[model samples]
Target: MPDPTQPRKDTRGNILFFFGVLILLLLAYHLAKELEILYVSALFAVVLMPVLHRITSWSIRGYHPSRAIAIVLLLLAAALGLILFFTIGLPPVLNDLRGFMTDLPGRIPGAVDRLKHIPLADKLGVETIASRAENTAAALGSYIFTSLPDWLTHVFDILTTIFLCIYFMLEGEHAYEFFLSLFRPPARQRLDATLRKAELKMSKWLLGQGLLMLTLGVCSLTAFGILHVRYFVLLGVLMGLFNIIPVAGGVITIAMAAGVAAIDSWQKMFGVLIFYLIYVNLENAILTPRIMRSSVNLMGLTVLVALLLGTALGGIVGALVAVPTAALISVLLEEYAVQRPSQS
Candidate 1:
């Protein structure tokens, strides 16, 4: 009984709607790319805000907000300068990296040959093990040097990021307040609480994780130095930085260390493995739990979901921020859905 014209109009409307959505999505993507520096700066500012706040407060008795903010900006600038200095000075480090890579494959087989003579290798096979070692070394070399252009791009990106971070540190509070003022008083209060919770969680996570990484790097460098490992400083720093990756960080650290050690000698390779095993257990049992306690306590499933969603949205940066954002969302949802109902 429906008119044919009505159906035709409906189809047209649907097509228009679909196209509109597509256009909007494309626009959003473009805007995000254009403002990438701003977003990254904002993220860094948020992470470091608590440190700035504390320093500001301590120096200026009754929370002289402006002075506190200025101090934070200064600290941020100093940190960025240091990072830039090191990044520029990294050619020698790269040369050492190249040396390590070239030497690794030859060193690994000798170590594997030593392993073949071991009691455990008597039960397993020697040729099979040697083949596996070769394959692993090849894969590692490929992984290390496959994307030179991408590395250069990332380095350039870091300079822009530093500038953005300074800008955000300076203007963050005003921007936050402006956004917060958009809602009704009660809604604003709720929003403020949510923001505070997220900021606190993120700040604690950043500070604690930063300290943890520094400690881990120091420990790794010292241990590797004692073991006479090649490129110990470089490897230690890489491991420490990558340790932020969640769950798989420790495994990757051990794998990289082991691969490098395999190039040195069998005894060194064995020593690296043993060191990692002990280190990992110690980290898990002592350090991680302590560091992570103040941060958002996300479920494993939530973390995986966040990671996937983040990667889909923004690659590495997305993956880095996704877990914390998801945790904040969970907290907000719980506050509204469960807590509010109980209160009523």
Candidate 2:
């Protein structure tokens, strides 16, 4: 019943379609940065959807808040948290910082003098090392001044992402519909289900990551306080905040803590190192698996690869989204690409 005149397939049309897709891929590569911003904004909106839904579901005398109202409430809550931190948690740290800066010059000489007592300390050229440290600090100040414009650009990008995220949350459904319309109904439904699964897993990631950060912060505060480490408050806060950055964050903060401890005594420095080593072991062996595994179900190797690739491609923003993006990709692969025993 095949018609010879019609031909078996539209070969010309297929070739044109292939070329069109290739052009799109090239264009996407050229504008990857802008695409990344939009993708990140969309990902954030997806992750926050659960919280937004929860807020909208609350009925105040049968008057449920709209998505826009819910988003505003969430923003207000974040602002309140920042205000509280600045008011209550920051003052003691600021006071300690001021005192530390005032005493740094006096303390450095003593630290260097103490170093002289160690065997081969003079051979190591402690004074030279001290001078190098001072030079490094001056260079850091210069770098900060030079990077002001870059920092401003980053702030603008952040603001753009925030506004885009809000817009997505408010009107994402329409966009979603349009996106799905590109596919046949069967494929569209399957994708919708797969993405829903991914979203649930991604939301759980946020909760698990938050718990891990808080636990580390509390533990750092207690241990540093007991060890009488200098600027324990500030160090603890830094440890918690920097935990968001994965391996690099922990290493940097712990090294900083050890350096501060060393400024006091070798024993304190050893204590800081030992504490960090133990904490890292516990976090890796116990905490990460029990918390993150249940949330994302990703293997250690996969997560590590994702983090490396993300950080390489997008820096902090890439790293921030790496695990969740991996989760999403994993789900899609399982649905469409993976070969199950039954399918085999």
Candidate 3:
């Protein structure tokens, strides 16, 4: 029998342990922003690790790249793309914006006058609506102009994230091993296996999502160009970049496109809307089913729910990684939580 002097439990020790946990929780709450950046950086590293491995494994005349070299090559390619965008693709868009801003004051009167011709103009207070829109646009412009410091801070955060992601890519294995060491052997092994499966799913997800983004971008570019939409290039780029966010991204971009088209003609706006409608249908019925379904192995409902929950919790960044995060959680749940049927 156990010694009665040992006592059934150490009440003081238990209270102290719980108090320490509460202190840690408070610290975590205060440091949430930094934690968010670290989380996102680690996630991108996990998603890209397989690609880095593939690059390292490549042989050109028996020459294989080291991990550092492979990372440099990827960074160089990304830098080149950015340089090209700044030099070529961004100029016309910038010029158009400058011209539009300059002409906005002159155009507002004519725009309001056009609205006067609408059947419900008086009842709807169209002129008042136009005045408010003008004021809103001016305020938006002023805010942007005044927010240079904030924008610079965001740029610094982005650079910090990139550097952290690179560091993670280089040292993540060691960190992962250390993390696993915190658990007992059996649990550690099980977690390692589960995380490896999740990594595979995440890498596949990045590739599949990339292809979808490119497809939508190219199609938007072609359709908008044929219809002679203003700022088609800019719109197309936005469509592709924002498509990473799923449903809301597409809706926001399409609305902007339709509004731009409406500046010229109602028919053009309808055309833009119709194109997006058809594309959404085709994507849902065909492209997504073929590409994402195979790659993610997730149901439509699961993805939607994940996206919604992620957005509610972490905004745009959360939405960006939500599917892959869900994949990771799903694998863990299957292994540790979900009930399995007994064999007959």
Largest TM-score belongs to which candidate? 3
Decreasing TM-score order of the candidates: 3, 2, 1
Sort all candidates by lDDT, best to worst: 2, 3, 1
Candidate 1 segments whose C-alpha is farther than 4 A from its true place: 1-24, 35-37, 58-92, 108-151, 154-156, 338-344
Candidate 3 lowest-lDDT run of ten? 98-107
Worst 10 residues of 2 by lDDT: 133-142
Candidate 2 per-residue C-alpha lDDT over 59-173 given as tens digits, one digit per residue, 9 for 90 to 100: 9999999988999999999899989999999998877666655556557777788889999999998999987776665465457668989888788888889999999999999
Per-residue lDDT for 73 in model 2?
99
For candidate 3, lDDT tens digit of each residue in 1-344?
Answer: 97775554677778889999999999989998888899899988887888899999999999999999999988999999999989998897777666555655556767677667888788998878878878877676568678978878788778889999999999988999999999999988989998898888888887788888999999998899999887788788888888997787899999988877777777888899999999999999999888887767887688899999999878998899898888888888878888778622
Highest lDDT model number: 2
Report model 3's TM-score to 2 decimal places.
0.90
List candidate 2 segments past 4 Å from native: 1-9, 91-131, 284-286
Alpha carbon lDDT at 273, candidate 3: 93
Tens digits of per-residue lDDT for model 1, 4-119: 79989999999999999999999888888646656666777888666666666664455565754665667678879779858863664677677776776667667666677678
For each of the candidates, give the backbone clash count.
0, 0, 0
Error of 1 at 313 (Å): 3.7
In candidate 2, which residue pairs clash?
A: none
